[model samples]
Target chain A: MTNEEIRDFIQTAIAENRVMLFMKGTPEQPACGFSMRTSAALNALGVQYAALDILPDPRIRQELSAISNWPTIPQLFVDGELVGGCDIVTEMYESGELAQRVGVEQPQHEPEPPTAEAPQSAPLGVENRLS
Target chain B: MPTATELKERIESALPGSEANVEDLTGGGDHFRAEIVSDRFAGLSRIEQHRLVYDVFGTEIGGPIHALSLKTTTPEGQR
Candidate 1:
C-alpha cells in the first residue's frame, strides 16, 4: 500500500478504537525488548487493549514512524490517540496515568517483577478484541 | 530518502511566514526537532498545530526522518 494509505489506515484504526498499541509483536509474543516492556507496563495497569504488529509489513512500521514522528516501535494509543513510546508509557505507568487513561480501576502499586512483587498480572494490554 | 537540507527546505517552504529553527537532533541523519513560530496558531489547539507541522513532512515523515519534537508558538504567544 502507499505510505499515505497506510498512514490513513493506522490513524483511522486508532481513531475508531478506544485503546490500541502498535508493537513489533503480538501481546502474547513481543518481538522487541521495548515492546516487551510496554506489554509489562500495560499489564500492570490491568487494562484490555489491542496490539498491532508492524513487523509483517515493513511499510506499516515506516508509515507509523512518519505519522507519529516517533522512531521506535511499540507505540501506545489511548482512546484512539497516540500515547508515547515505551518510555512515555513507563513514565505514565509510574504516574498511574496509564491506568487512568484506559478506564481501568487502578491496581495497587507493586514493584516491577524480578525485584518486588509486581501485583498479579502479565505484561501487555492485549485485549486485541477491543480494538 | 530526504537529506537534512531537503527536509529543512520542505518544512520552511511549505510553512509560509513560519519562522522555524529546524535541526537534526540525532545527527544520525533522521531525527529532527523544530521550534516553529507563526501567527496562524493563535487559536488553534495544540494537536491541530502539531498536525500542521506533521503535514509538512507528509509521507516522507517516517522513512528518511524518524523523529520530530516540536515546540510551536505564535509571534504573540512567544511573549
Candidate 2:
C-alpha cells in the first residue's frame, strides 16, 4: 500500500479499537522482546486490545513512525491517541498509570518486587560491546 | 552505526543546554538508553518528551539505531 493508504489504515485501526497496539508481531507470539513485554503488560491487566503486526509490510512501520512521530514499534494507542512505547508503557504499568489510561482495573497479581526504581540508570560502558 | 558518544553529542547539540547521558544497552551498538535533563522537556508530556529526543535521530531511528530508550526530565525534576 502507498504511504497515504497505510496512514489511513492506521487511522482507522486506531479509531476503531479502544486499545490498539502496532507491534512487530501478534500478542500470542511477539517478534521482539520489547513487543512481548508491552503486550504482556496489557494482557496481565486482561484488557481486550487489537494488535496489528507491522512485520507484514515495512511501509506500515514507516508510515506509523511518520504519523505518530514516535520512531518505535510496539506503539500503543488508547482512545485513538499514542500512549507510548515499551519503556514508557512498562513504567506506567508498574506505576498503575497504564491501567487507568486504558480504562481497566489493575490486574490482581504479584506486585512487582521493589528494586531499583530507576529504569536503565546505569550504563555498562562507553565501548561498543557488540563487537 | 553511531557510537554511544556520537549519539550523545548529537542529542546534546540538538537540545542546547541540555545534559545527555547515553549507554549502549545491549553492547551491540544498536540498542541504547539515554537520560536527558533539560528545561526544554519541562512542559512536555512523556510522549512529547520522548518524541523530542526521537526527532533528533529522525529516520536513523529503527534503522541504524535499532532502539533508543529514553528517560527525560527537566532540571527541577532531577532526582
Top lDDT model: 2
How large is the C-alpha RMSD of every model relative to the true structure? 6.9, 9.2
**Tens digit of lDDT per residue, candidate 2, span A55-129?**
877888878888887889989999989999988888788889998998888766547622222222221111211
Candidate 1 ranges with C-alpha deviation above 4 Å:
A113-131, B1-79
Q: lDDT at B64 for candidate 1?
A: 69
Model 1: per-residue Cα lDDT at residue B42: 77
lDDT value, residue A84 of candidate 1: 71
lDDT tens digits by residue: candidate 2, B38-75: 99987788998898899899888988999998888899
TM-score of chain B of each: 0.83, 0.94
Q: Judged by TM-score, which candidate is best? A: 2
Angstrom error of the Cα, residue A70, model 1: value is 1.5
First chain TM-score, candidate 2: 0.83
Error of 1 at B38 (Å): 24
